[model samples]
Target chain A: MVESVEGHRLKLLEYEAKEYFRRHGIPTPQGRMVTTPREARDYTAELGKPVVIKVQLPVGGRGKAGGVRFADTPEEAAEAADALLGMRIKGLTVEKLYVEEKLSIVNEIYLGVTVDRRNKAYVVLASSEGGMDIEEVAAKTPERIVRHLVDPINGLRSYHANLVAKRLGYGGRKMLQFAAVIESLCELALEMDAELTEINPLAEVGDGFTAADARLNVDNNALFRHRELEERLLESYRGELTEREMEAKSQGLTYVELDGNIGIIGNGAGLTMATLDTVMLQGGRAANFLDLGGGATPERIGEAAKFVLGDERTRALFVNVLGGITRCDHAAEGIVAARRELGVEKPIVVRMMGTNEEEGRKILNEAGVETLGSMEEAAKLAVKLAEAS
Target chain B: MTRFIDKDTRVLVQGITGSQGAFHTRLMREYGTRVVAGTVPGRGGQTIEGLPVYDTVVEAKESHGVDASIIFVPAPYALDAALESVEEGIDPVVVITEGMPVRDSVELMARARLSGTTVVGPNTPGLIKAGECKMGIMPAQVFKKGEVGVISRSGTLFYEIAAHITRVGLGQSTCVGLGGDPVVGLDYVNVLRWFEEDPETEAVALIGEIGGDAEERAAAFIGDGGFTKPVAAYVAGRAAVPGKRMGHAGAIIQGSSGTAESKMNALRDAGVDVGELPGQVAESLKELL
Candidate 1:
């Protein structure tokens, strides 16, 4: 049931965003990601200055959640890295630490560029109040925030950047510099195909500015054009993937593991969610959520079935398909093939309708696979089978 | 007397040579929709299933005087196709392409608004005026001509509810999938407005899921006397865990805003009947009716 337009987006880590900033001549504190305490200590020693050790997680509110710490010495940096590496922030374990030279901030300014859904344009938001949650600022002090909508066709112009900068109370050289920064950030957002590119607390250090913290969310739909980013994402999440999930990803299937006994599979997202809801209503929990996507072939269905059946937690399998473009016969063939190839003994309940459903049901019935006419009946049977098992 | 489309509505199929375009065109034609012309860039003079194909929406409009366009263009070219229809002054353009880049959708929606054209679905099943006209990819057997108008963000969920409603002998005036994307051309408010103004539609069934403030916005609109029609609502993804996306790109609970419970509460507060299950939607609307 994956919305073809809304694919999974990947959030870049702080260090990754810093790399992009460095490439684009945007000022950012010198930083490198360290997976080990020794590496963190070495980087701190090389910098010869006080540094901030931040837990490298893709989630927000890191500072408020104790994911950010300061270290004045190499020993302290190592200790901080040790404390953060195994820490859990927002359900994700911090396996790496971004150790960067801490900068003296005279003022904190916020700069962000995101697509404004209502306006249907890219909006660049800037505020004098930074280094804090922008949402909180918007709620508490709405006057501090200034928003400028950039035309998608004309792109972000220098005048537009200056307008935003001026609104944020910048003037003269600082205004020009901030405008330049906003322009560069907009360029970076365009280059990276980002849904959001933000620099909270763009630190005003000495006579210039440096992005103290950076956040980037790359659009998943546009990821096909950016293979390197996809590779990096895969590499970063290499440790998080279960064997089945990894296999499914390789085979181009959307699979999410859940703690349940009934493995649920469907053709579309809406149908899959409804199937999950129905399973729960029938006193059953789904083991996983698997979508075969649109127009699944027999081979692809077989592969998906094999992956689900192979899960040790899965006690029964429920395949609910309301086929439109997806031919039901192909789905049936895949299920039958998986049953024979994997020799899965789990009770499989298949409910399919639309697009050659009769032929599909015939194939399933011929293979001795149970085919139900309704999703409700199929869910009840799957739950019954799971409970019996 | 459907809301947006009818048997007399002159239809143009965009990307007619494509597999989905050809398939649904035949289905729409079979269902009695006047599919006048088709647009397929290079297949201008070619005929597919006896429908004349044009190179552009302008060409199709100039020749056949098309009123509405059902787009079957791929995701990459969906914006251009929709814009083409909008530029040609088509009243409503139904885009069936999925996986369109959100940025492109934003641009297309903006242009559509400027041109005073209505666009539906960059990733949706489109719209069907039960028994009369079908512009989407939904199974035609499930819908029957009636007075209830249906709007949903999820395609399959809309079908499920439509099927249940039909099974319960509550046919629909029109059913629309707004496309389950973070950004879409039309929202619940737009559809609700149409249903409210639609003399044929007595009641409306809103199928929403966890994500975005569209449901809440719809509730607010209804509360502000925007929609006078009796509204029955069903929200999917009740079992969906937070942060984890359940199929629909826009069906994720971000913070506390887009939750099934929250949406239900909002709708209930707005004096709309809320169904606990898809099967219960018909019964819920019956209470209001």
Candidate 2:
């Protein structure tokens, strides 16, 4: 099982995220993202006093982490915007500030939609009281939070939506509107194909409706058909690239191009990562982590291995793989195929398992690729190879 | 005879103009997969590696009776390319394109539901019935026709399982790549079901990881007596750090319960002899049979 979530952290910009929520009919405070601090002053004035000034980063836990702040005055807002505008938090450069008009927020509550890991279904989480330090909210009043898992097929029914609102002490015809928003959010979460979405301080300002302080993380997996949503994700990348990394990226190869001797060829993003970790831990740094990816045939492996070996920093090569759907023997064949075509001038460490292990070993051994046992052993050998190089 | 795919299954290659598309399409032909047509819009009627190219999946399918397809389109074009195959009435689409955002996969998969078309992967290695048809980029030379059936989410783990099986003189009847995408069409349960009904397949080898209740659901199906066939499950990520997921979106196990340990426990509880080492799966299967 190759389990990985790549391209996380970089998220849709605030203007886009809010627009997405607003387009989905989910209530969010009216907001604008400004490029310059001058626009920040204008948006703050337009939003009036008591507005939230957030850095508009993609990562979660930002509010508690102080990536988000509220400004009581336009002057305070401009200063806040300046502080966050160019601030780099967790590799994401904060480029814009989301200055939104704050709502009355009588009863701040926490509501979220996430894929419940245990049940393998979409779940709806609601709390009567919202916001004030998420940690404190979860700790001080755990009982207020109501959770419901929705069957992806059946979806979140009206009663299920009402159940959350009723638990939150909402009722009457006004309760229906609350249900509508909750239902809308849940529907939108599923409709938009989100991984998780949180509306902390889903407020109860007026009797009938409330606004949502929306934080929606659409599942990147479902972005294909959602042209608008897909566009939002393009905004997620940092887009900052070093010259070499950009050159590698152009070829669709994720080449970190570290100052190391061993070039690792593997499949599965996680395995590739583990390979990197192993190599680093074993007193060796990797030139690059090349996941030929699953279904990497001998030819593709051959090509990837050649490319990895071609790097000037590469003095040795580490090929680690566990053939799940893609066979290791084929990868081994690719190694031999590539080496024969390109010639292996450097020592290669091979640790391969899964489908056709014997054949894989045989092919590599015949080609003179030294096969190791475990990933740790492979790393140790790689370290040894690097030192020798 | 194989159920889902066999030697005679007519095929089409999407993105046939690209190097990846052109190369893999040739391999499909060499492996005895009857690749009748290919698609690379504006490169219509041209031949790449000697296979006829078309403008779209619709035209290719209409002209060639293509039932199974292997797509080599880039990530950006992968969704529409896969969907075009689906729209053209193809079943069992094997999408080899990686980096397709998760959302595109979900949309394509949901659309597959509407048409009853099964998409193998947006990020996956396609399925193959050993000694017969090859769907994705499976290395045909390593595979041998035998009774042990295999299914996996990651293409590479299939190699380990096959290697172990081969060491014991066992070979695969059918190897299905259910794919790594979270929203892929076939899952553990689907392939397991096919293995259960396949006459030639004696024992089934399930290669799985954490995340997605695919493993647990397969366990439920097995526990409910849906699978009379013996199952041996080998799950990866034991060496993986607590929070670290492997590749493939569905492979991630968030929260406490989605760990590989939990998945292994669930499978064992359902009577699957889950293996820890790469070679142990074949050993467990030998005991069961």
Q: Pick the lDDT winner.
A: 1
- The sequence of per-residue lDDT tens digits that candidate 2 reaches over residues A1-389 is 11223223224555665676787777777778776777878778876668877777666556766778778888888888888788877667777777888777567777777655334456777776676534355566767667787755567789988888887788887577778888888877767666766677677776645554666666654566466665555445444334555565456554445556788877776456557656776778777756666566777787788788777788889999776556778889888877788765788899976568888999888877899756678888988978897
Highest DockQ model number: 1
Candidate 1: segments with Cα more than 4 A from true spot: A1-7, A23-25, A32-99, A126-129, A133-176, A224-230, A236-244, B1-3
Tell me the interface RMSD of model 2, in angstroms. Answer: 5.9
Q: lDDT tens digits, residues A350-376, model 1?
A: 998878999999999999899987788
Candidate 1 positional error at A163, Å:
5.7
Worst ten in a row by lDDT for model 2 chain A? A1-10
- Worst window of 10 by summed lDDT in candidate 2 chain B: B238-247
Q: What is candidate 2's CA lDDT for residue B162?
A: 71
Worst 10 residues of 1 chain A by lDDT: A1-10
CAPRI accuracy category, model 1: acceptable
Candidate 2 - chain A - TM: 0.74
- For candidate 2, write residues B1-289 as lDDT tens digits: 2368888888888888898787777777788888898898899989878778999887887787888888888887888888888887788788888767654665676678778887787667788888888887766666888889998877666755676676677888988877766556677777877788889899999888666677888889999999988889877654344333344555554445457778889899998898655457888887787
**DockQ of candidate model 2:** 0.17
